[model samples]
Target: MVDQSAPLPSVCDLAIWEPVLRLTPEDGTERGAGRSARVAGRISPSGYSIAHRGSMPSTARIAVQDIQRELARGGVREVVFRAEVRPDGLTTLGLVWPSPAVEPAYGSVNLGVLVLADGSLPAPWLRRPDPVPGAVPAPSADPELLERTLRERLPDAVGATEEEIAAAEARLGVTLSDELRVLYRVAGGDWADDVETAIRVDKAVGCEIFGVEHLFGIDAASRFPGWDLGATDAIRTPPDAVVQGLAGSPGWIGFGTNGGDVFAVDLTPGPRGHFGQIVLLGHTESLGAEPVADSLTDFVLGRLREERPDRRGAELPAVAGVGTGRLASVQAAAHPALEVLSLDGGDGPPFHLAPVAGLPRLRTLTAMPGALADPLEVAGLTALEFLALGVQEWRVLLDAGAVPRTLKAAAVTVRHQDHLPVVPVANEILALWDRPRIAQTLLEGDLGPAAAPA
Candidate 1:
């Protein structure tokens, strides 16, 4: 409807950006008068796709898909756009090319540097378990009964020996919790030749309990959202929280899965948690695990509830947002232990970054285009390893020679304007770190005039 099969990255290629433009306010809708959008998706000979959030008017939806189709004709395979328009007109139409530069977190609109050019992960991945001194198991923990219950349920189940369990502890450097050790001793997690995984679940255990040899501890990097969505992630454990909200812990012995999600025994408990509680790691979530049962005994007894008492999070979040309907500003989100600060792009004046410039543990910062009052202010974030900001903001930083030298990776956010000019700015960023610069083929064409407003 807006534009079809336009040439890829062609010079003066107005048609290439027209489809996206139609979705903006130039059509004269009051709602589109001034707005910004973040989009990510793939395009190919098959057709075009877009990762737009929420429902859209049918006309806009068709235009959204058309944008990919139009860009595909130009040889663009994948696209991530940070586009904005105003009552006056679009000042900057920004497009981030070779989306692979940003970590591929499929089905999610990931912002910022996910993986460094050196093939290293962000700070969150390097997190290790904190020392939980004198931690002990809960009163409900019953190694003898846990093993006996499984023995009764799976009478034919083949179990592991104590020597083998001891061997696992030696190999992993983490002692298995009492209940967990017994659960493996009873079933050893492996199924027999005659019993299918599903059949074994119904016959004895409600979940597929893993074997002694299969256990992996806190360093288990199992989730698939990749580094971008996870690099800035943090968890909070409230005073009454049963599980210590953590990115990862050496004491969390991952034993098995609930058919899909991984299950672990949390030896490093929260102040309110028991020593050996059963916690679940979501298959898709890239962050923290939640408490599922007081002990493995409860998991086997079917006495489990999925809800967490402090499900919303700690009174103060390790990851904070500055926006409307949320924390009012950076000062509100600032804390000594703050790890991430994301400035939301609502229709407002730019936010000042001075409030959080001195947070010691702060490592990641992402702001929507036009979201920051001064990009140079980011130079003060010495601990920053990842930074994402608008191209204009980056120019001010680059020109002033103020780009934070501590960044391991960076992303250039953009808003409505020609993309060709943005490529130089992105390359400048990569050049700063001596990282690989983006290579894009440019083609030029004009799609004529804008259509009359409905």
Candidate 2:
């Protein structure tokens, strides 16, 4: 039998670690010859760190995804990993299997909302495609011109059959726009691999066009707006706005990418938008798509351009932050349309929720430790559905039975404390909803001191 003591390949593999210890920002503390890392963050070469995140660089991320799936197949809901390096050159690693709540610490792709017994989704995820009862295609929508232009560009390319095109539409449960229908009829994307497909599409169509079989509706699920971030998103489609600021829309037919973003055809127009306008959905950002051109015709005719529309003074802001460099206080962030408000407890004074008390749309509040003047002040934000606070604040609420019953999810935020202690608090919050508790099993192992660098 093979030696079972060897480490199982997982995200916890220290060999795959990035310079995270390098990116952690300095905290006026120093590690002597070997005192271990003084602080934590995404370590960088500058003796500081970036945000805590999973692996990037594609390769590492894919490996993490594969391992997570394997773990899930084995009935693991979540895995929380911890690595401690001591001044004596001893490193200890711990793995918490089947964590009760979906831990977001590192190498996690499960960004969905906390489980609710009724399976209710956050407000942002509840959006459906708005009806454009009498909307017509934008004036620039010229299917004939688009087809002629594409056919001219790819004379030798193969076109998708009428039956094939219909099959794709049927699978997506929506009819394709005339220009898009014509575009595919001329030449449906054909490539053996994603890399070659991207290369071919970039050269043939000025961007990466998904194959006929790859077409999909850019709905909320595609973005995976987990509760942590989704709860804070607000829908703001002003009467004059061109693109509705929504989590997603059924009318949005996603057909291509700019490598890191998506391009879609809008079937559900905003109050001022035209049907069949071309829009871009940035993969890195949350919610909403931005208009790139008036129509698919314009998009292919050298009118292709991506300019971020000015949302400032154009619509009501949806998310706000209050802290030392952010809004002066809760009063400054108050608005009838506000949805997510985050308070940072940097070096600034504490904040009072009095200014934002009773705001109808407020649903998610994330207050760092010491950020709130009074932990009980949160009781007044009656509309809150997801609240994240420091352990002490949660303790106060847990003790007073003052936790907002409206909360569908809650989290205990901590900076320097080990996660083992936080599990109980998270379980306490989950108990309020009669939801499943976060369960942690500690498995520890030690690796002798690090080897000297060559």
lDDT of 2 by residue, 327-349 (tens): 77788889988888999959778
C-alpha RMSD of each candidate structure in angstroms? 5.8, 7.9
**Top-scoring candidate (TM-score):** 1
The residue-level lDDT of candidate 1 at 138 comes to: 72
lDDT for residue 447 in candidate 2, whole number 0-100 = 36
Q: Write the per-residue lDDT of candidate 1 for residues 203-292, one digit (tens) a residue.
A: 465676666787888663544245556656766656676776666677888887867887888988877778888888877666678788
Error of 2 at 177 (Å): 1.7
| Model 1: how far residue 451 lies from native, Å | 5.1
Clashes of each: 14, 12
Local accuracy by lDDT, each model = 0.66, 0.66
**What 10-residue stretch in candidate 2 is worst by lDDT?**
41-50
Tell me the spans in candidate 1 whose CA falls farther than 4 Å from its real position.
1-48, 51-100, 104-115, 196-198, 201-203, 218-220, 238-240, 305-307, 311-317, 344-347, 417-420, 448-454
